[model samples]
Target: MPNKIDFGNGSIDFNIETILIKKNNPEVKKLAQFYIQLFQNPNIQIQEVDKLEFTQKNSIILGINERRDAPDRYKIQVTPYGIMVEASQVKGLFHALQSLTQLVKLNPENKAGSIRIPTVIIEDEPRFSYRGMHLDVARHFFSVDVIKQYIDLLALYKFNNFHWHLTDDQGWRIEIKKYPELTNVGATRSNTLIGHYTDRPVKYDNKEVSGYYTQEQIKEVVEYAKDRFINIIPEIEMPGHASAALAAYPYLGCTWGPYKVANTWGVFEDVLCTKDTTLNFMKDVLNEVVDLFPGKYIHIGGDECPKARWKTCINCQRNKRRFNLADEDQLQSYFIKEIEKHLYRKGKKLIGWDEILEGGLAPNATVMSWRGETGGVEAASQNHDVIMTPGSHCYFDHYQSKNPREALAIGGYTPISKVYAYEPIPANLDPKFSKFILGAQANLWTEYIEDEKKLFYMAFPRAIALSEVLWSRKEDKNYAGFLERLQFHLPWLKTQKINLTNAYAELDYTLSKSGDDMVLHFVKAPIKGKVLVEFKHNANNFTQEYPKGDSLILSNSLDLKAWYQLQDNSLCKPIHIIYNKHKAAGASIQFIEKPSPKYFSNENSIINGIAAPTNKYSGPEWLGMEGKNFEAIIDLSKSDTIDQIKFQLYNFPAAWIYPAKEIIVEASTDNLNYEVVGSWKLSPFTQERYIEPIVDLKKNKSYRYLKIKVINHGKIAEGSPGAGHTAWLFLGEITVD
Candidate 1:
C-alpha cells in the first residue's frame, strides 16, 4: 500500500480501499462512520480491525499515544495491499480523514471523481505548549453542555488549553466537595447588575441568579478534552477576592463577618483570613481540584488584593509579625507562600496575578501579569516565568470599540485594533527576559458581562486577535492582513451561533479646517433606529454618566460627546437626529463660529476649566491608562503655540473598577505625527482634579497637534464602583511668546 495517491504528477497504483478503526472503546464503530463521512468516500469500507492486527499493520488506532508527536499526528505507512494511517487516538484518525478529504477535488468532466493525495511526508506539531482559551465563568456561568461546546470550538481551532476561571467576587461556578454550600448558597446571586458597573444604583430586583458544575460533570469535561488533547486548567481565586467564598464561609474572612458576592466589579476590601483554618480550607479545595484537573498549573488569583483590610485585621497583623514581615503588603506574600507550599506538595505549581509580586513572588511561582508588562518584566527579571496578560490589551471586558456611550459606562474603550496591535513584551524590557514570557491570555471579567451571547460578542474578534498574538510571531501581525483574516472568521462565527458585531471596518473621515475651529465627522455605516450621534474632541475629558433619552433613553452618557470651545460657557449639546432605526446612518459636523459662548446646560459643568499645560496633568480618561509606551499627536496647525496644557481627571471610582497609571505628553509638527514633550504621575486628588504642565513652545510656530500618553505604574487605590479618575485636558489661552 502507498500513502501517497498522486494525481497531478503521474498515475499511481495506490488506493484507500478500507479503513480499519480499532479500539477497546465502544464508540469505535460510530467514530469509524464519522471518519468515513468526513472523508466523503462512500466507496471505502469500514470494519472493526483487531487491535493486535491493526498494530502490526500500523493502521488507524485510537487510544492514548505516549509518543510526543503521535498525540495529534497522522502517520501513514505503505503496505503491500493498501495504505494504513496510524492515529494515536480517534481524534487523530478524524483529523487524518479531514486531511485526506482535502486532497480530492470535484472533477469537472466526471462531476464527481476521486481526488488524489500526492506523494508527501509531512510531520507537524503545535508551536506552543499551551495554546489556550480562557473563559470567565465568574462573570456569566455557562452550562456544562455549553462548556463542552466551547471545548469543541477550541478543538476545532487546535487550541490545547482550556482555562476555566471558576471563581470571582460575582460568582463561584464550581462545586466544592468539602464545602457544598459554596455552590448551593454562594453561587447564587440575588440579582445581577443590569448595566455597566459605572452606572451605579441600577440594581435589579432580587432575582435568583445561579448555576454550578458538579464534580462528576467536571470529570466528564476533562475526559472529553483529554480525548482531543486539550488540557483544562481550573482557577480558584484566593486572598483578596474571596467575597463569594466569604459569603459561604464568613469565617474565611479576616473580618469573620458576612460579605456578599460582589454585585459590582472592582477590588473589594474584604479578603481571606491568613489563619491556619483558612489555609486548611484552601488545601481541601485544592485537593478536590487536583483530583479533577491533571493540568500542571493551578491559577491562584493573586491579583487586586488590596492591603486596606489586612492593615486592620488582627490575624493578618499577627501573621505579618510571625513571618517577620516588613509591612501589611508582606502579609500577602506570607499567605501566597503558604498556599504555594501546600500546592507544591500536591505536585502542582502555583500561578497567580502580577499583584502576587507585591510582597515577594513565591518560589517557582508563575506570574500572569494583568496590570501591564511591568509585573511580567519584574517577575521575568527575577527568574520567575511570567504570562503577559496586561488588562490594557488582554482584559476583554473592556469595550471593543470607541463608542463614548459604551466607553464612559464600561470604563474605557479598547478598540479591536488595539487588541490586535498588543505586544506581550514591552520594548523597554531586556531581550533575555523573553524566555520567561510564556505567553498571554485575555480576561473577560463579568461585572458587565451577563450572558453567553454577550460573552461571544466580546470574545470572538478579540479572542481571534489574541489567538494570533499568542500563535504567530510579533513580526507577522499585520493589521490589514489580520483584519482580512478576521473577516473570514466572522462567517464561521455566525455559523457557530456566536453573537458578534458584523461591522468590521472603522469610520474613515478626515479633519479639515473650518474657519477658526476644526470640523471632524465620520461617514457612518447605515444603522437603524434613532441615530444617537456622539463625538469626542481628543481634548474634552469627562466621567461616566448614564444617557437619558426616550424610554430610559440616555442617562449619564459621556460628556465627551458634546462640543466645547476655548472660551465657551455652555457645553455643546449632543446632536441627536431621528433616522430609520433599521439601517446604519452617516452624519457630518459643521463648526460655525459662535458670537456668544456656548456651554453645556447640565448641572455638572466645568466653567473656566482651561488650565496651563503640563506633563504631570491628564484629562479624566487618562487616569487609569496602563501600558509601556504612550503616544499621542495633537494638531496645533490651527492654533498658536502655547506655554501651558491643563488636564482634569476624576478620582478612581471608590468602586475599584478603573485602571491607574502614569502619563507622558508629547508635541507634533504634522498632523501625521508627535514628539514626547513631558511626563507625569497621577497624584492623589479628591473627586475631579487638575494638573498643569509648563513647556516652552516657539512663538508663532504652530504645530499641528499635541499628544498625551499615559503609562500605568501601579494599581489604582480601591474606590467605589465608578470612582476611578476621569481626566479632562483643557487648552488654556495659547500665550504666543
Candidate 2:
C-alpha cells in the first residue's frame, strides 16, 4: 500500500488522447506504450517532448525527479484536469504506471472510448527489498512462453525476485553445454504418478514427459525479467535430489555403473557422491550455470538427502574417514561447503534449503527455510540471511479450501487468509538479528499441478495477498480493502486469459460445539455471494437457502452439502460433511498426548459430530501424531448407555502414516479409576488403508468418562517415503453409540 493516499472529492473524466514523456528515451517510451495498451483505447497516443510541463489539460505525464526518499518510491497525483506520475528511476516509474493502471476504471455510464480516474495523491515504496515468488519446473515442465507469462504476472504485482527451480529428482530441466547427456538422458521421465502418491495399487500414466530450456531460451527469459526488474535465481540440486543427474552419468553416484532418472516423486536414496570426481562433475555443471545466469545467488537444493546409501557406499565411507568426519551428516555438510566454495570462486553466493543447517551450516550460505521457521530463526541468530517459506503458509500446492470439488493438490491446507497473515520475521527472535531476515517467498512445487491453468488457479489470489504482505506496511493491511481492489483486476485477468480461481467467493464452514449442542457455522466470503446448503437425512432430502454468515443446528445425523452461488450465478463445488449424532457428539476431551504442531487442528474435532472422508486424512477433522500414541479421556457430561465404541485410523505407508498397533477402551464414573471394557490387538501388515477398529461391550453400561488408548506403529520399514523415520499416526472422528 502507499504510505499516503489522500482521495479528493469528485473524479477525473480522463480522456487520454496522448501520453507525454519528459524526453525521447527508448525505455521510457516503451513503458509509455505498455500503459497505453492497458487503457485498451486506440485513441490514446504517446508523444516525446523536450519538457513535460503538464501544460495540456487532458494528458498523462511521465516524468523523473531524482529527489525521492527511496529508489523505488513514487508519487501520483490526479485532479479533475489531468494526471501526473513522477519517480526517481525507471523501476519507480514502472511502479507508478502500475498504480495508475489500477486507479483508472471503465466508465459505467458510457461504455466506450473514455474512463474514470479517482482523484488522489499517492506516495508509496516497498517494505522489503527482496519480495520473491518461486516455481518448480523440474516436476512438470512449462514452456518458455509460459515462463515469460509467469514473470509478467509477478511484475504486475511488484515482485522483485523469481526463483526458477531448474533441476530435481524427477528431471533435470536446464541445458548444460559440456554435459549433453544431462538433457538427452536426464530430461525425460518414463511415466508419472496417476493420482495422489498414497493411492494404493500405485498407478501410472505409462507415458513419456520431457523438456529442458536451451541456452538461448534461458537468456531470453533473463532479459525479459531484467526488463521488468525481476532477478531470476536458478536452482541446481546437489548432494541430494540428484537422481536425474546421476542417471545421466552413473559415475557421479556412490554405486556407479547403473542409474535411471526417477519416474516418480519423493526423496531418492541415490545422491551425488562426495568423491572428488563427483565434486568436479558438479563444479563443471555449475561453471556452465554461472555463465548463463547473471544473478548473484544460486540455489543448491540441500534437502531430503537420505544417508542410507552413503552409510554403505565405499567411497563415501572412505571420504568420511579421510576428513575425520564424525558421521554421514558431517560428510553431507562437507559436501555443501565444497559447493559453497566453488560458487564463491565463481563470483556467486550460495542458497540452500533448511537441511543445510544439518551437521553444520556453511560460513556464508543463505538459508531458504521450507520445513518451518526454526531453521530461519537459527540462521538469523547466527547472522546469516534467511528467506522464510514455511510449508504452513508459503506452499501454494496446498489446498486453498476444504472444498472437495477443487482440483487435486499436494496434501496440506493454506488458504489465502493464511498466506496474508504470514509474518516473515519471527516474533520470538532477538531484535538485533532481525536485520538478517531478507523477506519471504511462496513456492509452487507442481507435483500435483500438471498444467498452466491448474498452476494459475493455485497461484493467484493467494499470490496477490502475498504481494501485500511483502510490500505494504504491516499497519496498511486490510483484507476487505484488498478484496475490493482485486475485484477491479478480475476483468483484466480474464482479458489476459488467466485461469484464476475464485476462492475468495467460495463459502467456508467451521464445526464446533456451543452449549452442549453441535453447530455448523458458516463464515461469509469476501465477495457478496449467496450460499445454499442441502441436507440428506432419514432417507429424505431438502435444500435450505441462507445468506452468508449463518449457522445450522445439527439435531440429527445427515449428509450436509454446501456451495456458493457466485455473482455470475455459477455455483461453486459443494463441500460435503458426514454428521453423526452419537452419544459423545459434544463431549469434552482431555488429551494425555497431544498432536504435533504440523497437524494440530482444534482440540474439539474428534467430538464435533463430524467425520472426515475415509481417504482424506489431511483435513482438519483428523488429528495426527508423529511417532506418538493417542490417549484421551472424553467426558460425556452425564452418564449414558453405551454398548459400542467406534473410531478410524489412517494407514498410508507411502506417506508414512500407520494404523494402530492396539486399541483399548475403558470407562470411569468419577474420572479417577477405569476398568477395561474392550481391547483389540492388530497386526502391522493389514492391507486396509482406512482401519475402523470396533469394540463392542456385551451389555449396555452407563459411565460419564470414557478413556481410549491407541498405540502407533514405530519407525517406518526399510522402503517407504520416510524410511527409518518415526511413522505418523492419524486418528479421525470417534463415536460412542
Candidate 3:
C-alpha cells in the first residue's frame, strides 16, 4: 500500500541476528520485539547495539528522524548491507515493520541460515487518518484474549481506531463501577436465539448467555491497543439501544418496575426515558467509560429507537411540551444533545449513528452512516465530520459469498470485490465537503458470529482488502497487484493458523440475457487457475475447463456450478446458480411502481431466467417494496399459449416482509383490453423461505401481454418487528407457462 516503491534487481539475505535502535527508545525496542515474534525461526534473537555495524548483513537498523513531513511516512531500504527502516514517528516505524514482515514472508528458511528479503525502496503512508474497524461484542461477548487477538490483526493491517461496541439490548459487555447491577443483570440473557430471527415458531437454546469486562480488564485492553498505536473508541449506546440499561435499573424506563435483558436481536420499544434521572445515570456511565478509553470520541448509539413507549408516557409527553419539541424525534435529539454537552464538558467529543440526524444533528458530533451514504453526505455538507460505514460495502456480518458452505450470516451479499470497489468518498459529493469525510470503517456485528474462529473467518482477506482501500491512493489501486501480494500473505496466515474464507479464489460470474438465452460470463482470476464449469441446458449436461474469461450460454432451466482449479490440484469453492427458463424469461417487462432503494436488486432480475434462492430474501434475485402494490406488465414478444402463472414471495414477518394478500393475473392480445384470467387469495405465513404460489388459468389462452397485480399486506400486525409500520413486500422471479 506504499505510495512509491522501486524494486531492485536482486534480493538480500537477512539473518536478524541483532537490531540497532537509533535513539534507544524503549517503545521502539518493545515494538521491535513484537514484530520479531512474527518470524517462524524459533532461534531468532534481538540484541540492541549502540551503532549500526555494516559487517553484520543479517542485522536491521531502526532509526527515528526529526519530523519534517508526514509523521506517518516511512522509508525502507533493502540493500547488500542490511535492511534499514527510517521514520519521523514511531507510527511510521511500526508500519515499516509490518511491511518488512510481508517482505520476508515471516522469515522463511533460506540459504546459510538467513532469510531472503526483497531488495526494494519503499515509502508509505495512510490515505485517511481515521482508519478503523468496529466490533460489536454486546450481541456475542468475546473473551479479553480474543479481543486482543482482534486488535493484533487490526494492528497488522495498520488500522488506527478500534470501535468497541460494548453495550446493546442483547447484553452489556462493559462494567461500570457505580452501577453494579449493570453487569449482574444486564450482562446476561435468559437464553440465546436458536436460529435465524425469521424462523417460524421462534426457539431458544434455553441456556444463559452472559459476560462483562471489569474496569481492570478494560484498562488492560486499552493499554494493549495503545502499545500497537491503535485507538480504542468505546461505544456506550444511549437514548436508543438502551434496553440493557433499562433492564439493569428500572428507574431509567418510563414504565419503571421490571424489564429483562433482551434475549433476541432487533430494535426494542423500551428505551431510556428522557428525564433528569436517566440523563444523570447516562452521564455517570460515560464518566466511567471515558476514564477507561483515552480515545477522543465515544459512540452513543442513537439508531433504531422506537417511540412507542414515549408516545404514551406522561413524563415523556411533559418533557416534550416543556422543550417545545415537535415530535418524538426531536425529543431523542434533545436527549442526545444533553449527553453530548456532558461529554464535551469532560473534554470528549460525541459519535452517533446517522439517526442522530433525524430531528437535529448535535453541534459537534461525528456521524457513522450505516444505513447508507446519504446521511454521511448530508452531515459532511453541513460541515460535520462523517465516517462512512454504509452497510452495503462495510457490514462484515452480511454473507461474504453465496456459496452454500458459508456460515449463516445476517443476510445480504457483499463479496470481497465489492468491498474493494468501495470508495470512501462518494463521487457525487462536492470536493469542498470532502474534508469533512474522515474515512470509512467496516462493522462486524456479532449477532450471527458466535465464536472466535467464525469471527476471524468473517474478517480476514476482506479486511486485508480494506486495508488497501484506506491506506493506498485511490488512483494507484491495482486489484491484480493486491491479489498477487495477498497470495503471499495467505500462506503466512495459514502458518499462523488464521481461519480465512477461500471465497477470494472462487470464480465470479455475471448474468445477462441475449436473444432468449441467459449468458453467464466468468471473469478470469489473476492467479494461475482454470475455471471448471458444469451446467445442464435443453436436457443436456455439459462440463468444460475454461482457462480464461469465458462465457456460457444457457438455453433451458438447470442448476449450474463453477469453480477454480489451481495448479496444485486444489479446488476453490464452487458457486451454485439456479436457472429457471420460464415463458417470461428474456421477455420485456415494465414496473408500475419501483421497489424501495434500500432493498433493490438488478432491474431485470424478474425476467433473467433465474429463480431466487428461498433461503435469502435479499440479493440479485429479489426486489422489495414497502407497503406498495406490485403491478407489472410482461410482453412475451409473440402470442403464446399460457395456462399457468407462478411467482415467489417472501413472508418473513420478523423482518416486516409479508407475502402478498392476493394475486390477480390478466392477459391481453394487443397490450390493451386485458381480461382477468385468474385470481387467488394467499395465506401469508412466517418462515425461513419464500412461498411459490401458482395461479392456474381458467383455460388455455394465447396472449402477447400479461398483467400481474399483487396486493401487499398492509401494516405489520402488533408485536411484529415493525408493528404498525408499513409492511415490506418482496417479489421473486415471474414465470409464465
Candidate 4:
C-alpha cells in the first residue's frame, strides 16, 4: 500500500508467474494463449507455462468446469497465494478475462510496483438471455475496425446481441455478391443532408458520400464477434426503406425508371414491387445475408412501408386480390411471408420491426417494437417474441438535453434516466406470455450522427444504462449506485478513448407554475455533480447564482440558467431557461377534449408559458388533437378584464396537420354555461408555417371562465402523410392577455 501510485498518470501492472492449461482441450488452449498475449496490452510479457502450478504465489491458474449448467457464468477467486478462474464454457473464460481487465484498470495501485489483492470469490452472469445494442451503419458507415471495436465494447459490457442495421433509405452497408450493384450503387449517395433531417426545405452538403463492407470483411467481423460471444443480427430492409435497393435495381420497384439512393432520411413512397422477378432478386440478396451471418435471426425490416406506392402499383393491387389480401398492409404481409419462407429454407428465423404485425405476422417471426410499447404489447398478446426498443427510451439520436443549442439532433428527448427506467417486460402483460418477451436494446440511429466521435458520445452512458437494465436484476438496479460507479468508470473510458456524452453534466430540469401564480416552480436532479442555478432577478444579464431548493419568483421576466457543475469547476455546458412571465404562465387549465392518446399525456404547452413545438408533433411540448376538436377551459382563479387570447399551430402538408377550421372563444362567470365572445374561421395558409391565431374581446369583458374551442381539419384525404387518418390540430401555447 505504501508504494501505491496516485490515481492519475499511473497504472498497476502484474506479472503472472505461470498460467495453467489443458493440452487436450481447445477452449482452454485458446484461452491460455489469449491470456499469455494479453500482457502485451500492459507492456509486460511472460513465457508460456506447460504445467498447472498453484504452489507459486504469483501464479494464475485457469481450468474448465463443464459441471455448471449456466451458459456464460464464471467464477474467479483471487487469493494471497494465487488467482484461479473456472468456467463451464469458452465464453465464460473470455468474460472472466474481461473482468480482470476492468479490475486492472480500476485498481488504485501504481504501474511501477506489485500490489496485494484480497482473497474473495466473485461470480457473474447476465440476467436477460438477449442483451442487445444496435448500430445503423447504413446512415453513416463505419469501417470494419470500428465495427470490431464496437463489438469489443459490447463484449466488455457482457452484451450478447449486436444488431447490425445494414440497410436503409439513405444507403446499404453490406455486400451481396449475387447483386453487384447492391454495393456498387446502393451503398452510395449523391449528397448528404447538410444539417439535421428536420431542417425545413432540406439543404444539402457539397460532397457525395459512400461506404460498404466487403463480404470477406463482414465474415471476419462475424468471426471476431463470435469469439467475443456476440451474435451479429444482420438487418436487410425490405418492401420499405428500400430506396437504396430500388436505386440499384429499378425493375424491382413498384415505379419504373430513374430511382436513386435517397440522400435524405424518412419513409419513402418508393418500395420493392410485389412481383416474381423482385422476389427472385430478394432471394439472391438474402442468400448472401443468411450465409454471412451465423446467427439464427435475419432482420427483415417491416417498418414504415408507405402503402402509397403499393396502393397505386397495378401488380400490387393484383397480388392483393390474388392472395385475398384486404388492403396494402396485408400486401406487405405477403412480401414479408415470402422472404420468411426463403429464410426458413435456409434454416434461419425471420425478425422484423413491429410493423410486420400490420397485415399479419409471419409464422415464427420476432417483433422489435420501436415506435412505442403498444406494438410490443400487441405482439406479446398474440404470443410472438417481442424485443422492446421503444424510441421514447431507447433512441440515442434524440437530444439528451433540453438545450436547443446542443448537438443538432432529430426532434424529441430521450435522456439517460429514461433509458435506465425502461422495463422490457410490460407489467400489464399476462404472466403466461412473459417468456415471449426477449429483453430490450438501445438503437443508435445515425441519421444525425455523422462521425464516430459523435456516435460514441450519443451511445455511451446511455448504452451503459441499457446494459445494466438488461443485465442486472430488477431488485438489484439502483440509479444512485449506477451514477457512483459511472464516476469511476469514466476515467477508465477516457483511457480507452471512448468519447462519452458525459450526459450527466446536462441539466435535466422541469418547470411548473406555483399555485399563487407569482412564483415559478423549477426542479432539477440531485445527481452525480452540482446543480447550479443562475438567474436574472427581473430583467438583466444572467450573473447571479440562486441557491438550490428555493422558489424563483417571476416579475416582468425570469431568465433562468441551470448548469451541471462538475468536480473540475469547469461546467460541461450551460442551458438557458427563459420564462417571460406570460399571462397564462400559472393559469389552471382543463382539457375539455384532450389530445389523442399518443400526444395527450406529454404535451404541457397550454400552461407552461413557453410557445412550444413551433412544428407539429416535432417536440414533446405541443398539445396535438389529431382528428378531434381542441377544447380547453382556462381557469384564471379570478375574474379579470382579459382583452385577447392567442393560439399556435403548425401546418405541414405531408404530416396531416393543418390550421384549425374555426376557433371559438367564449366567456362565463359560472362553470356551467358560456357565451360566445370571439371567433375566427381560418384555412391553412402555408406549408410548415407556425400560425398564431388570436381572438380579441371587448375591453370591458371581465370573466372568470374562458372556453377556447378549436375545430380540427378532420380526415386527411389520400395524398397527405398519414392519409385517411384524422388530420391533426397541433396547439402549443394558449396565452391570455
> For this target, which candidate reaches the highest lDDT against the unseen true structure?
2
Clash pairs, candidate 4, are 11-111
lDDT tens digits by residue: candidate 4, 416-439: 778887888887888998888888
After superposing all C-alphas onto the true structure, candidate 4 shows an RMSD in angstroms of 4.5
Candidate 4 local distance difference test against the native = 0.78
lDDT of each: 0.59, 0.86, 0.85, 0.78
lDDT of 1 by residue, 670-722 (tens): 64566665555655552332333334444454554566553433333344442
Task: List model 3 lDDT by residue over 461-556, tens digit each.
Answer: 888888899999999888778877787777778776788776767777777778766787886567777888787675888887754548877786
lDDT of 2 by residue, 156-259 (tens): 88998999999998899999999999999999999999888867678899789899999999999999998788899999998988888998999999888488
Instruction: Single out the weakest 10-residue window by summed lDDT for candidate 4.
Output: 1-10
Scored by TM-score, the top model is 2
